[model samples]
Target: MTKIFMAMIALLYAIPAYAMDGTAFLKQVDRNLNPESYESYRKLINVEPDGRKKEYTLFTVKKGVDKVASIFLAPASEKGRSTLRLGDNMWFYIPNVGKPIRITSLQSVVGGVFNNADILQLDYAAEYTVEKVEQNGNEYLLYLKAKTKTVAYDRLKLYADGKRKLPAKIECLTEASMLIKTIYFKEVKDFGGGVVRPAVIETDSPLYKGYKSVMIFAKVKARDFRDEAFTLTFMPNLESLR
Candidate 1:
């Protein structure tokens, strides 16, 4: 009983009263995020400075480490399109082209604007090291440094809702010490058991001033996915995965 009490005390100290310890916050975030049995309806709206707007709806599913799939539907514009990221490989399906293109590690990302590595959602524990913690009013901040050059962002600053333990904002710094992008979590909802997923994610880039991409999740479903669903053989049938 004494040891348990000590552990509890250590945990309390590790988690700040107004903010979570940098490393400890990440540990909790990792624990609370379940890659398996996760699926969501994502609507991505991109607004350009030229006033041109494009929207796409994606059905996303994740089974485990390096296993993911996205099916494009809607707007009557993006039909029969899909993308699959399995392990380290990313495959792109274009109905107009009638074939799938595989992206290599050396090549750039295909979908949206973020780098492929960034979208792949690499394990946070492997990619970043927590540096410090801070508080801004009611928000708790976590400063992180990239562990390797493979990570697109050299520095990461995360702001979390103090009471909710959910991310409120993220600042990603480029290697040049310039702000690359910032993501704001507008709404967070508990889904599938006790996991908290963002209902909307708004992303803005320094390169594209006055431009932003808003992603809203319309529906979320949790299910068991097979390893084969993320393979090249199944890339053509991405729409059927759902």
Candidate 2:
């Protein structure tokens, strides 16, 4: 009887260790994607059901956990437009408006599968808590829950590569578990300074049936910036940072 009780106690102690391992791996995945503060360039392409496509280029900068900013760099119309995210607060700045306008995580700035929250995303570990983790064959499936209601997606199903510890796909869902969109990470590349991650991210949604969006990342290198660089006043001056 004492041996059986000891085995049961050992099993109980093992449970929490398993849970912590999942969360710890999640943090590692986040760091593998990008440095805490860095800059990069991305080309966003939106495709219609008819194959018509529109593209926009952006220079993005991210600072510690809750600060990120992005500015349009190509296409004359989108040039000079910028977006900033400071914690739960987000804002869009237009050249003509000359003032920052508040925005929500659910709203799309460029109109596609990716929303404002996705474009200016912070570390996943920052906005989400791992609810559970499962190992499926060669992949790790992470069940994530939003830390707060203000988050864009209520829950996320993240499937990561077991060998690389990088995300392979993510499914965004509503509170009632309705499917919103699925994001696929692809084309891994090394951008120097230990920054090796997916260079292409494609997303599609049942809600936006027949439409798709793709983001191609480039020049994703580690670099530091001042706090002012992620503020509204610096939105117009974002280009200068690059």
Candidate 3:
């Protein structure tokens, strides 16, 4: 009888230790990945099924959860091109055209598996509400649903490191739970000034078959920027921020 009573007490105490608030836990994982506002340099590589590869470098900045801007830094053909995203609205600007144009979230800026939404991703906490959380061995699997219809992906399955609380993999999905793409976070590095997270994000999509895309991150440090810096008018002047 005493052993039964002790076992019941132990079970009662164990529940709260792993009994996590899904929403709060997801927010922690998001912050562990990146600051709310910051700047980063990324090299995007797109590999064709035939083994040919094309790469583009970009300098990117984000303010809050909704505002992000990026400018191509290499490949003369893609250089000077910029993209500005504010909430659900996104625009692409070409230097020769000298104007900003609307773009859909699923459209790729550099023509790869990654789309504009993937490139200019907002905080997972801001866009998704945790629908379920499960412990899968050493990782925590978080099932998320978009907070609004305008969110880029209707559903997301995120697998995060249980100890680090950083994402290990994320699966973007449609409303019907159809898989679109899988993003793998790898090569954790300390980027100085308290930023420590994945240095590489590789993605593959069923739609693209054997093609894959990778984004290598560097110099991801925290910084403050003006709201005007994320506007269409600021697209031409993005280089000035660097």
lDDT of 2 at 37: 93
lDDT of 1 by residue, 119-158 (tens): 4454455568988777655677787898877566788888
In order, the Cα lDDT scores of the candidates are 0.70, 0.91, 0.91
lDDT of 1 at 102: 79
lDDT of 3 at 136: 56
lDDT of 3 by residue, 78-138 (tens): 9999999999999999999999999999889999998999898889998999988877556
Residue 164 lDDT in candidate 2: 88
| C-alpha TM-scores of all predictions | 0.77, 0.92, 0.91
RMSD after CA superposition, every candidate = 7.6, 5.0, 4.3
Q: What would you estimate as the lDDT of candidate 2?
A: 0.91
lDDT of 1: 0.70
Question: Which pairs of residues collide in model 2?
Answer: none
